[model samples]
Target: MSAVPLATPTVPRKRRSEAELKAIVDDFNATLAADPEHEPTADEVAAWAAFHFDGTLAVACSMADAVLPHVVSRFAPGVDVLFLETGYHFSDTIVTRDIVAEDLPITLVNVMPELTVAEQDEKFGPRLYERDPALCCQMRKVEPLARTLPLYEAWVTGVRRDEGPTRADTPLVTWDAKNGLVKINPLAAWSFDELLAYAGEHRVEVNSLLSDGYPSIGCEPCTRRVEPGEDPRAGRWAGFAKTECGLHT
Candidate 1:
């Protein structure tokens, strides 16, 4: 079992007002607008955010891999790493989450939706993901994350541009107006190979399913193993028109 944080570590710096936060995003973007190609390295970006947001920064991780958390934690030790506990993950994923929480300098936040799997089934009927994946995702993933994101002034995501067309334009930093926070994607420029290399170099705990061909891991029932030459994200929400779970969209 994951050794979850009893309580989130206190951020010495108070969260800035939304207006102030938005200005910071604007300033950062404007500074980098002149040379997108000359953007700072991932570690440099993480350091900038760590200094600016401090305790108000949250990292969203799916436990598919711990590379993002490992990278971010170097700059902000004991940062809160939010994991949506939808109660539908594979055993391997749960194990990986457990190991990561114990091994890394991070606080594990097991964010849960209002409804448990049983409650969701009792309320909305079983296998709702088959009937309506969007609603299932909204309840199990999106809504829960939306409710939790407001506590922070900024967030870090593991999104990479090489994942697929849907994420081809992922930016390193942007004002996530939808979540009302400054969104940071430090791994935006990394490829799958680069991610694996980092994990190997740092000895980060990775979900076993990743090597089992499930590159883009999501809920167990909704995810599949990708065939060769297929896009990494093709395994997620297979047979459906959904490319995203509505968190980034």
Candidate 2:
């Protein structure tokens, strides 16, 4: 057979201005206000967003076990769910990822850091997470996310007011200055108990590790089990003088 042409990758175009973004939010809010119980269908939301934004929407799957069903059940299939695969996750975390991906009706897009573990170690030296967390995070999390952010109009997150200080004021909708795209926090006001209740009510699959003192899970080397009365995310990047992996920060 003759050689077939490979398809060219499509780079996302520039995003709308702040004024345009504000208008879109205003319109969305109006729609929600007019019919609180009659929320726009996920397909409808995705379609509406496509007209305005030009970047890939992402969600940290850390606690998504509680919300993935609602997002999948409501949104269109093939709606991208970008998972940052930072190459340092625990085995259980990977297993959980497999379980979630197997069941969800989303187009799971696994985003990875540009370098491999060995390569990263070679370049930056081993255990760089202990030495320079912010730089390490920039290499592993921020840069990878920035690479893909321009592919969708908005990104969704599972952040909640209960997560703690940094995320306490996370708006239901806001502009992410760093990524320059609309960020949607559908579960902003949801309490941890509320999330648990929803998961129980829906029989959603959760990370097995969650029951084992790991309220927040991330790369294996950085994460640990939290103590009682500690923040749920305390286990993540523990003792590294860091909290968020730059998704929210």
Candidate 3:
């Protein structure tokens, strides 16, 4: 009897084809669309995502002022929250980062540009943002995000449809073919007013810059206080041809 040992059984691995994955997203979207009266909670959405893509995905919370709380609550503590720490951010933005770290259940992953600020300055001179905005963004924003994205199976963003043309087509769940990962925008349908209302109702701490007319905060060299009639994101990368940090684009 000792001559033959029992063979171990192997569990079959599940491999989802592109169409199957798309079907999952599409079905979820259809569910949400059909149940328009019943707004899905953050927990519900997170649970569904976790169930479908368990052990194969990571949540990338952006920690933006509007959707940070929702993302934090949806994903458990120590989940990766990616921040593009461009080193050119304002002191206030840094303060906000610390505040978020203390208050939320998040593991902050600071994604920095390959080039040091000093190195960049030496190569392109100080205030390179003033000269070539696209190149500056490429070094500061795009490159860092591109480097960090490959480390995860999925990423979560704080984009909302009301943010305007740039984010209007944001889906609740979609494939990022370029990055080869799933991109989830849980709060895609929420408006700025709705976001603020949720924050107020939940007692979420927001960045101080928001109160000072800096609606969309970014690198210190490019951000400014927007006028009353201007768009919320107008303050970021002002006077530059850049609208987004290349994350959405």
Candidate 4:
């Protein structure tokens, strides 16, 4: 999240009652999880979410790769893809995001934090990520996302099961208690190889850092290149026990 220009404010959309949304999630969970042996493909899940949520859906992309947005936009063209502009991203990440917005059949929503990088530095002192990554992420990533997510009834994420232990049991569909909306992880079953394969097959624009050893790209300051045989997300928040940025948990 480098210092950038102001983001276009997203107009909050009318959301359905929480009860109705929760019931929908319950129904989807039951229907999709009915079969023990068979699981739905990412495309199948995306299609289901597309039809069910329709215009009231959003896809959250870290710009690690454009595969998630590419997969979902096939079913729901012009869907809003929310990119958290924390003003601390790697240059490659930003480049990938811009390319995805131009190439994909979706609307790009630049979700910015309430304060700019300078303002945050002034108030919280410089290099807060080094002092307390959790609080930094809360103000930069989680809060901004939480603020923008309500404009949609449901939100789709690219969280894969193999990312690490924290997301090992991620479900395909569930009620997002934290965000108060339907949460869909279409690629929950996908492996790193599967992800790259899809990106290559579809000719999607991927962040250059992926091939350069930064398996899990995050804010420049908190991220580093991971060694071979390390956890895919080992590069993120390197020195702390912080596994998540307070988004999924």
Candidate 1, which segments miss by more than 4 Å at Cα?
1-9
In terms of TM-score, which candidate is stronger, 2 or 4?
4
lDDT of 2 by residue, 67-111 (tens): 643454354444466667778777776676666667666555677
Model 4, residue 78: distance off in Å is 0.4
Computed on alpha carbons, the lDDT of every model, listed in order, comes to 0.89, 0.67, 0.68, 0.88
Off by over 4 Å in 4: 1-14
Question: TM-score of every model?
Answer: 0.95, 0.80, 0.82, 0.94
Clashes of each: 0, 7, 0, 4
Q: For model 1, how does the per-residue alpha-carbon lDDT over 181-232 read when each residue is reduced to its tens digit?
A: 9999999999999999999998998899989999899999999999999999
Candidate 3's C-alpha runs over 4 A off are 1-23, 30-43, 54-63, 69-72
Where is model 2 poorest over a 10-residue stretch in terms of lDDT?
Answer: 1-10
Model 4, residue 138: what's the lDDT? 97
Error of 2 at 208 (Å): 0.9
Most accurate candidate by TM-score: 1
